[model samples]
Target: MRRTQLLAGSALLLIAAPVSAETLKDALLKAYNTNPTLTAERANVRAIDENVPIARADGRPALNLTGGYSEALLQGPGTNSINSPDRRTNADTQLTVPIFTGGAVRNSIRAAETRVDAGRFGLRGAESDLFTAVVGAYMDVIRDEAIVGLNTQNVRVLDVNLQASNDRFQVGDLTRTDVAQSQARLALARAQLQTAQARLISSRENYIRLVGDEPGVLDTPPPVPGTPAGVDQAVEVALQDNPSLLAAQRSRDATAFDINVARASRSPRVGVVLGAGYFNYLGSLGAGSGVDVGSQSGTTGTAGLSLTLPLFQGGRPAAQIRQAQARRSQSIEQVTEAERAVVANTRAAYAVWKSSEQVIASAETAVSANRLSLEGVRAENSVGNRTILDILNAEQELLNSQVTLVTARRDSYVARFALQAAMGRAEADDLGLEGGALYNPVTNYDRVKNRWSDRGRDVDPQPVATRTNESKPQGSEVTRPLDPILDTPVDRDAVNAPSKRP
Candidate 1:
């Protein structure tokens, strides 16, 4: 007996231990950790970082090493070759640093910087997308599970109605048709339960696909936060805070830099070059042998500045300038379109969220009313004043109302997050992801801009400079240093932006 008790206790413990629960916070963290798509986005961001250094390289000098070995035929008819017989080795090394490239160097650097900024904004946009996907998947599973619970309760209610019908029929209080009606309702309820179970299974699979593991069971969702003040408030938040919009803005900035880069190609480029050389030869002059540099100097060094003024380049520079200008125009339109989209989504999501709260409240009341009706009908049936059909109808109504309530509660919760997401304020921080990474506008931006500001540092960022509103301007041009993660827009300078604090 003691052994039996121990086995039963162990089995119960196992069942209890497996009943794990998950919440939205848990879902987002897991998605961030395990989702391959999000990881791919991060890799893309890192790849863009290299562009900053590439642009910076343009502003610096380029060094090359030249080496050659050759054997020469004697110009003379006899053993006397012009200098040496098939045995000469020459080596030269040159360092060419660009002192000036019209403004090409600076322009290229700016374009690169803008590209880095675009990439960072892209990172933020990616974060927002992943945030929504995780939340939606989480909500899908929770909603279906609630539906399953409601279906099970519906089956139970049908069972009670079926029992009542049989009791009434035996005493002639209910007819054959009434009994059949109750039986049919029970069958239908079972069918619905099966359907709800199937949906729940699919939902669970989708959740696990994104989160990398089965959530098993979800805890009850919390209530949505109170509504925002109005449509304007939601729209304002979305425009001010959305990463997507910032991405578009950065794209615009990049195009603007492109215009400058194209224009700079037309100016003169100046550079300095330093060279060193060595020449030696070893040969047999017919019967006479000689080993030496042959009276020629073995070491030499030269240094000078080279200026390359673009007189003409087949109209390519002009074409590039036109292309960049067109892109700038397109970027402007895209930014305008993106802003409109933000406002529309914010308003739509907020409307749904507010309406759901009211709907859920009303549904709760309806469920209570239906439950009261079911109880009253059962009492009437016992006294022969109500038929089995009436009681079964009231029970069905109660079940439906309960199911509606569950849906309302779920939708309301989902809409709250949706509104936040739509307004661009929805973040991992808002969802309480613990110890989340802060926005690193500087780290990503310096990947591009830091090269211009700090040339002495041994380590350099990427080819493209990442700029943000957070960067402060240097002068007439927006020679500001910026952090890449910043999304907030500011108008510190039109021609030159300054003091960017992300």
Candidate 2:
């Protein structure tokens, strides 16, 4: 039973070597360059780009060319007939242009443009999610690697202790029971070391899946940038910049235009129609007629303005309007929900990050105290004031404390990344990933917005500019009314509050 306690308390305790190693930025860059999910979202944004041209086409002119040919036969009891066999051909060219639709086309274009804006924000949200995932996976690999090392050392140390106990038992200086205890502890340590190694392997596999490559000798991640000064400040920044909330806000704006589109159905539609046609008829004249007719041909042209007033449509337009209004309301509620979720998540992450700092500090102090205790316990054992078991227990305590410290450090780093994500800053550009590509939805939107051809651009314009979320420093300051009320200087104490029970 005590051996079980020993094994449980003495988990893996490892210190990573300080050397030239793979940085967190490198892993992040790898994920950013090749993540399939990010690539798919970028494609989704481009698909949204088509909505603009489709809406614009509604207000453009359309023309058609038509032609037909026919042959006919007529017979009348072997006598000359006025109606005889004949062949004819006809052709026409017609054009129609929309003059007005009570602003339907214009509003539709507005709605589509708004959706495109929302889609851009959606893409940004996806980017933040991807980066966050990469950060977690990278940390897991490092943590597991450290655990495996500690376990390996534990097994080795236990084996040496078991050998010493066996020699003492042979000399009758230690009991057989003591030797058995050492053997049991050694065996358990070996088993745990195996388990730790397996977990490391699993963590490496997950790292490969997310980061697009196996992890090398990974270095400890550097401190994340732009941590909020306080939890309240984090909430404020998130309300302003969280991509999900921004996306929801833009979605509400898009639905506002839907109301106009639905209402436009009740108004008059005006258009212009122009048509020209040519016809030819050929036959032999078999009766006495006023005019000779070997062949006849004529051309005709017509132009008119068309108007369609919807006097009534079985209340369909009114029903559509109601539906649009309901959707707009739904969008408004979604924005509110998004804001709430962002605030809750930001506060939660801030609390965790703030508390992890204290946990790490306490664990470090515990490790130091435990180390000193172990040294004194070993000195006592050499003077016959302590037993071999006492020394082993002291060492186990030291190792356990070291394990706790490592865990606390890992949690602190992960929480910091989480805090960054919550504040809408865990993006490649914000993280300063080097030599990675950033997908700019605006560049793709601008490329295809005005395209008139069915076949798209032969070559897309390359996005040469760097993408970032920060506002330009040189721009004239425009302050929102709520900013003065909500903005506060960074409070380190608020940002680093005590941890709470879950």
In each prediction, how many residue pairs overlap at the backbone (N, C-alpha, C within less than 3 A)?
33, 0
How would you encode candidate 2's per-residue C-alpha lDDT over 461-481 as one tens digit per residue? 454222322322221111111
In model 2, what are the clashing residue pairs, if there are any?
A: none
Q: Model 2, which residues run further than 4 Å from truth?
A: 1-20, 71-87, 282-295, 383-389, 457-502
Q: Which lDDT tens digits does candidate 1 get at residues 1-502?
A: 3234333432332222123566667777877655767667666776677677778787776667888877665455555543445576778999988887766667777777677777777777776778777777777776666566556555655665566567656866557998799899899999998888787777666666677766665555566454679878878878888878887888888887778888988988787889999976654333244444255336888988888878989999999999999999999999999888888878887887789889988987887777667767666555556666786687677767767776776677777777777766566556667646744555754545456443444456333222223423211111111111111111111101111222
| Native-referenced Cα lDDT, model 1 | 0.67
The top-ranked prediction according to lDDT is 2
Q: After superposition, how far is residue 304 of candidate 2 from its true place, in Å?
A: 1.1
User: Residue 340: error of model 1 in Å?
Assistant: 1.8
